[model samples]
Target chain A: MSRASNHQALLAFLDTIRRPDVAAIDLGEHENLVDSGLIDSLAVLQIVLFLETEFGISFAATGVDPGRLYTVSSILDLIDEFG
Target chain B: MFVNLDVGVLHEPLSGRRWEPARLRLEVERRAAHYRQQQLAPGDRVFIGYGNCLEFFADLLSVWQLGATAVPVDARLTPFEIETLVRVARPRLFLHQGELEPSLAPIFEACNVSPLDTDAVPQSEAQVPVSSFTLDDDALILFTSGTTGDPKGVVHTHRSLRARWIALQQALGLESYRRTLCLLPTHFGHGLICNCLYPWLSGQELFILPPFSPQVIMRLGALIDEHEITFMSSVPSVWRLALKTARAPQKGSLKRIACGSAPLTAHLWEQIQAWGGTSEVLNTYGITETGSWVAGTTGGPFEAEDGLIGEPWGAVVAIMKSDDTAIPPGYGEPCATGETGFVWLNTPALMKGYLNRDDLTARAVSQGWFMTGDLGYLDAQGRLHLRGRTREEINKGGMKVYPADIDAVVERFAATRDMCCFGFDDPLYGQNVGVALVLEDTSADTLRELHAWMKHHLAAHQLPVKWYLLDAIPRTSRGKINRDSVAEACAAHEPVDLANMLGAGR
Candidate 1:
């Protein structure tokens, strides 16, 4: 999938898991999901699940870099590199 | 300095800070002398507002040295919530490392309590006070609930705490705990009383981490392997993250791992065993009132089974038919083997009672046996198993968030006409907070104001993650809130569009 498509898919998945009081799409591309109050600490687990299921990104084999998953920009970069 | 405290080496792996026994003792003495200068005495309650570091332990021992009860406050609490507890506990000294929250200053002023800086200690290593404390005096008061209401602090005497440590030592030896890591918060009973203290106070090296930080959890295996941690205890949610994102520890130094305070399924239990490279992941059974861990899967050899609690460590586990505490010496006949009933525990390690709340204590304890609000049964093989809890608190992962506490805060808000907080099934946390609201106005302005009120009075974790708007909350015939029915009703309807609603107001 294209990087733009991956970003769209990731944003959709985040909207489902983000806190009810916050809009995931409203967050900046460089904004940290947790630090920016878009999601809870545990909600990161759902993001990991979304990566494996949708994009076939396996953290176990590639090793997780928390920074790569913290922001929309970093996540798109990760998809471009791994996907 | 006296050496009977049994405190071992304390380390913070994230910061790479370590305090040896001699250095720890000196730190404790300096802080103890500082407290003495501030006129801290026996029977006084000293609140430590921060934790998960070396200084926190020093302050704990220092408070004990002065015969004062240590109250470890959750720093996340809003100033309003903290003041509510301050009014109840009536602490003599509020110990924090640095500046108090700007809003918290007035509370100390009105309450006439001193906020002592732990870092600003006496220069000399003061000798232990003469006749400072006894084993029967209150050692710690860990608050379980009622942060925004009447806070219920579980008071454990030094004797009871020692009983817990001794009992744990007798049941679960200290060899495997030679190097232990704790990721749970120190304000919690399971974290302070068992996971941190049981091993650390038994003269073992303790490695502490900031509680529930995904960054730290992401590198959990590396932290464990670097420290060569032999034993660690955490909730299943943590294991869920570790098993997925973090690389498995390669050193194979894990002698045992324990998951408690939340339900651990057989699938997840086995997953933890594999990820940690050890088969000793025991699903521990404990509560704040019982001084944390009372029972776990420590009986001989056993396969991981759903709800299997194994056996008691230093307590007599009984499954009873009746939990009518209104009657004197409240207890009933024991259930037949393999029959589910109220799980009652008789332990020396049970908390003295709720701090200064005998009315609440009376409702929970009867005779010598404390009626645990848990429902479970014993197998023919003489093992205890947990089925469910009858308590009103929402178990968000391992952290117990009381529903009434949230309701108490929300009800006080002008925009909230009626509110009911309940637990909903969550994939990551096992259960998360859900609120059913009957608001005075459904307009975005009122909704935003209500959200602002909640954020001010409640911790982020305690705030309802899911919200439902209703005409009125469904209630029982007698007008009591049935959380389950309200939860069921809310599940049927779509939740309020809080993000859009608040955004519209903005």
Candidate 2:
């Protein structure tokens, strides 16, 4: 998958679960969903689960830094690298 | 009676500078009048919170005097959760004595409601008038354990609450205990009764800690020494941290260190006793249903055994088979004669019912007994030994598994520091065990080593199927693990591609 496709995938995945009315959830903009409260500690775990099943990928202890999962763009970059 | 809260009772007041019983009556009456002026009324639910210890206590009786229910809430809940609770309870008034206004302002806005703006400062001299309210009048609505979800409101009448208070007073001979420090939040049953009401009823002084801290506990020892302190009540976690970081209370000043809320392990209990100086570290058991602690040790302070929750105090306890029928005489849950089973509290303090949840209320209480979902067998002697929660038990390939049992063993591993063991959905077993752990060291190979270490102590089905190592586990403001969020974390699946479906953000 291309970089744009991976980014699109991440946005689509977030949309599936995120409440429709959440503001400032622009996947392309912010990199840290947690610090911004767009997503919380709970959301971070959901993102991990999403990455594993969608791409048939797994996260090892050292495979990815959690900071990489902060925003859709950073996550897309990570997914593209793995893909 | 002059109440000294810094230390447990130095002397049971045989006779001292006494406030005449008539004078105490006048004090209550005075508070009642103040609440009436504030327009508080019967059936109105008031959420009592703030950093000021005095305001939290005085406003309680004041609200009650004005015929309102004082619903104490932990100020620690996330704004979202707090907003949800406020909506559910629809408290007529919110009395907060701290700088939470900026945070609560947006929540109140979202709900399309305006909070009553009060002076940002707190008054120490606020007093209320005395009024005679029926024992059956709803006095408080404490929340249930949040292990499942945002805690539900458990309504309690004044009579029921008083019954619990009196029972605790009688059981512990609380007249003798003064000079208290409270680490528990004032919102829940245990914290409210033990720290707030108990001190008030005994006319003792209570210094409320803003939050639990190891540094604060160290200072507590010094304060006890400085003030000649006596009694303290804390949860197991607070005591554990104190043992690790601080010296015990001064030898002669402190009397008892009480631990409750979660199961107290034997090793942890002994460590607390050793470190708490001569003061006995007492294990206590109570719930919102019981109003306050119902069963505990009566001996000096420490239990003869580590994990045993003493005997049932003026409460009837039983162990039943899976069918809810009492286990036959020969084969009962292994509690001491008075101990075991779900640890039912037959006190008058059982909640009137869950607020707006008749179905849940019916399910929780039956046959004049509240069903505590805890699993334990009474010993032949009647002492209760809690194995942990029956509801929290995990099922693997038809084998029943207790997460606490496994967690206790796994936590003993040198590599593991703090852990939360729970079950997630699995196609094979319906629900398989999984664990999210914070390691003593965050190493690349830590997860691999943990998986191996768990292998020796746990069975195949009992072992954690998936391991997620965290820098820190998510905990509620009170520092208990947020199981619902953790379970949600476990159920979360990896993201699926979206390009084929909807377009990007509009």
Best by DockQ: 1
Candidate number with greatest lDDT: 1
Candidate 1, position B327, lDDT: 37
Worst 10 residues of 2 chain B by lDDT: B1-10
What's the true lDDT of residue A10 in model 1? 86
Please give the RMSD to the true structure for each candidate, in Å.
2.2, 15.5
Q: Residue B370 deviation, candidate 1, in Å?
A: 0.7
Off by over 4 Å in 2: A1-83, B1-35, B98-132, B145-151, B299-303, B323-340, B393-506
Instruction: Please list the residue runs of candidate 1 whose C-alpha ends up more than 4 Å from where it truly belongs after superposition.
Output: A13-43, A60-63, A81-83, B1-3, B122-128, B326-331
Can you write out model 2's per-residue Cα lDDT over B1-506, one digit (the tens) per residue?
A: 11112221211121222333344444444555544555666777877655324445545656676777887765544454457677777777776654555777776666544344233423343454445467787888876533113345889997787677677777776543666666566676777776556765676645555445333543455555655556677776555444433445555767776777666778877776666565366678776677767777664344546567777766777666442424422344433454344555566777898887887777777766777877776765666677777566664432345676567667777887788888776533345777777778855455445555665445444666566666676788888886657767645643222221212332
Query: What's the TM for model 1?
Result: 0.95
> What does candidate 1's lDDT look like per residue over B1-506, in tens digits?
22256678999998889999898888887888778889898899999999999999989988888889899989888998899989999999999987779888899989978998787775775776554677888999999898999989999998888888888899899999999999999999888889998899889999999998878888888888899999999998877777778888899999999899888899999889888899898899988888889988887889988999888989988888888665322336778999999888889988899987999999888876788889999998889999998888887777889999999989998878888999998866778999999988887777778888999999988989788999999999999889999999999999987766664554
| Chain B TM-score for all candidates, comma-separated | 0.97, 0.68
Clash pairs, model 1 backbone: none
